[model samples]
Target: MEGLALILLYLAIPGLLFSALQRFLAGKKKSSSTAKFPGPEQYPVVGRVHDLDRFGMWLKFKEWADKYGPIYQTRMLNQPFIIVSDEKIAEELLVKRGHIYSGRPQIRSLIKHKDGPAYSALMDRHDIWKTQRKWCHAAMAEAYKHHFYGHVEMEMKRYLGLLLLDPARFLDYTREYCGRVMSRLAWDEATQGKANGESADQTLHCMSVSGPITNTMTPLWYLPAFANPWYNFEVKRESEQRAWWLNNLRLAKDRYRRGELPNDTWAYRYFEQIQREGNETLEQAEDQEIFASCMIGFLNLVGVVTISGPLKFFLMAMGLHPEWQKKCQDEIDRVCGDEMPTMANFADLPTVRACLKETVRWRSGVPLGVPHQAERDDEYRGVHIEKGTIILACEWSINRVPEKYPDGDNFRPERYLEPGWPTYQEPLTRYPNFREGHSMHTFGWGRRTCLGQNIVDDEMFVFGAATLWAFNSGPKTCPRTGKVIPIDTTATNAHVILEPSPYQMEFKVRSPERGKKVLENYHSVLGKLKL
Candidate 1:
């Protein structure tokens, strides 16, 4: 009877669904000493798998950190993971010991996908990662200079116009704005709008699913083919993304051969590298392919979702706190008057920038900086972290540490400006909030930090500044209760994105003159865009 019941359940449940239970059952016999560190006990195959949610597992680690102190150890699905919440410890591991700590785990999903090795953000640190990051670093530096896009300022004004017309579709506009900007930036004159939209939509859906977590779990990777809906979903989209990616590459390559591609954009720069070396061999081809992969992949995984999530949180926060909104609006009006917010004037409008910075700290997109894996066995502060052990510089917890941020959970931008508080040094931009001290940890640390941090900061401020300047965004009063709808910062969406749940907010034109200027800018800006 027991055998029959077991067989029946196996038939009913998919192999992927059974992966966690199977690992747990298989891990019953193994044990770990955790030595002197304070952490939950670890079993063989499952280790600390039981302690974490199969999705957004870092949140569970935060709960454990509350119990275990700043540094804690746990094993997930037979893989070991170390969580670092303190800045000092994070510096020792991710910064000082970066050689070993910079590596990304060799997750099966990142490996088997068509362009995974060449383009994935979650790639293990290797020659490819180094090569890809080096090129990306240069391109991103150019991209940070808003002038590089030629007509980016115009595009931004058009974005504001779109928002003013359809404030309710703010989320959709954000996705579209990033989609086109990235598409044009990557492909130059040749781009597929439908392909870009498809990539964004598919990747966005991929974000909402449990694809990443399920794939990284040790035992789950080997699940039968039929049970891999999560991996399969991402893989299919990647394949679709590759189609357009390869097409763009082909067009750019041909244009480069004819000396038609621009010098400033990534498309031209990548092909120029190839033409300079005069080595368009198989390896170079693969490198170019990976470059293409990285271009779309970075835009897809990092660019679109990164900007859109924070903007959502920014709107939610501004609505929840009216005083901040009014304060920012007054600052924007004083700084730019009837003109759309410009990066040049960003320093003068600190209040709007502070609100955006607070939103970043309050609910970061990648709360746990892209998971960095240990290259080999290493010890930090007497704790043993084995080779392949995953290390998360828990940005969520680090940003919220009470010692650094007083009343840490409270949404207050003023904390960063307070005297005697820890401050980070700003190099290229004047946004000290992101650069100085603990708050800067949102970009992660050491070699594995976010490559596009600068661009995200500038774009976020422009959007926030423009939105706050022309329109009023605040909590919408409930029709039934006759009370303002409460903003629930505590409630988070699935996966690593820490955005507030969908909430109601009111967005109305604050000034007809300013609003008219926005519409005029949109119309004029489109004509000015060189692209």
Candidate 2:
């Protein structure tokens, strides 16, 4: 009797009916929300979730922007989202009303609040965010400019020498250059002067690899199932790495305890500021917290924005259009003659700067700039956008708008040379590069705009100017095919920050004499800046 009853319950007809009924009811509830926020006209509970996979989200976004004007609403996984493609709408929602929208969507599985583990700064826009930003800003202030510049010049010469030695592996060479720059900025130590190649390579490898991996992971967490299991696991991994960095920082703190910590770049500045404020003791979490913040801030600018994205674009541009490379080198030759484009040349070399701007616009690594969520319910052109709606500013669309640019899609640098045309259709009132406008959506909008914008602009200038001055870049011919296949600039799509597709190109030194001249000039001017 007991066995028969167990079998009936295990394969119960009533149990199966109940399960089906529960699913049907849940589906009905989801279907009910679709009627209110109609997104692309979907069947019952299916909604527009499938459409995203069918048509790439960004491409679909482009189509939606065209059909529904600058601001439109959609639903994904039953979550209502707002897309704002127009710059004006972005300014109004993300900038003017930033208080409500500045908060980030929580991805709890990825951004766990652990006992002692430190998380990335970009993960939270809270009290620590303010503290970290303020400390970094003052640390890299005007006074330290010369101190850091002096170090940078030495590294620049070293980098130029390395590039000349091995013209191939320009990506690796550029990474090496950026690593040295960032290390100097962070610790006031030259990467080349470091004891062994092992430590330096470890640092470089971390910087290079972390960019794409984190970029990939941050977005993946939004997808269900895939990002769920790894939540605590990732937090533990991050904590372990943070522990290592904290140990190094603790040594610095210990040295400071004994009054032996030498004043240098960022660390020096931070300590000086703390001393000046007359606050000796810090929070228990200060060392670990600061290290984590600095790592994120530094990498957000140097590893991801400054180096990976722009360096890849610079390489691709040089690879695709070798003429631009020659033109830049020629300009360098004419402007500096035997001297390299240093801090002084930066002002004078309008063409080279223009070329950098062109590269940023021509192959913008950030296609759909970071999405801004509306803080409160808003109305735009009769469209009622509810709060929590994610808004996208069409950066790629803005760059490729035909009305704003004559040959919008072409990679021509000369358009900028025309009087009153350096910025294409961008209004003169707004910043043209990196952070643009009252509500420029590239760096981001309002208080959330990238904190490291200045650092990025400077680093990109250095990397671009240095590369164009030194080598020629483009595709290599396959002996069998005898056809020149250019680097694919269209390999950009968003995860968090869009990245260039992996492609091969050759880097060759134009002239050893010219390279020596640039190095000499770099050292001479760099010594004066002290930065």
**TM-score of every model versus the real structure:** 0.84, 0.75
Tell me the tens digit of each residue's lDDT in model 2 across 1-531: 334423433344354356446655765754443323223664433246556632135667777777776666666433457766666667787788777666554333434421112433344466665655566556555533553454444566666666666656556666556656655455443342222122333322232212223222233333345533444445564465455445545555566567765565455555555667775763446765455444533432333333456667777886787777787788787876654455556655656666767776676655666655666665655555556566667677666655554576788777665555434433322233443322134566776676555555566666677767777766977668888766666765333454565677767766778767755655664553323
True-structure Cα RMSD, model 2: 8.0
Q: Evaluate all candidate structures by whole-model CA lDDT and list the values in order.
A: 0.67, 0.55
Model 1 ranges off by over 4 Å = 1-34, 43-45, 54-56, 113-116, 150-152, 189-209, 216-220, 226-228, 255-262, 279-301, 420-438, 477-486, 497-500, 528-531
lDDT of 1 by residue, 217-305 (tens): 43443446686555566667677666666767777777777778777667777776765778664245565575665564465445655
* Model 2 segments more than 4 A misplaced: 1-39, 42-46, 53-56, 113-125, 141-148, 189-229, 254-262, 279-304, 420-440, 479-482, 492-494, 515-531
Q: Report how far residue 30 has shifted in candidate 1, in Å.
A: 16
TM-score of 1: 0.84
Error of 1 at 315 (Å): 1.4
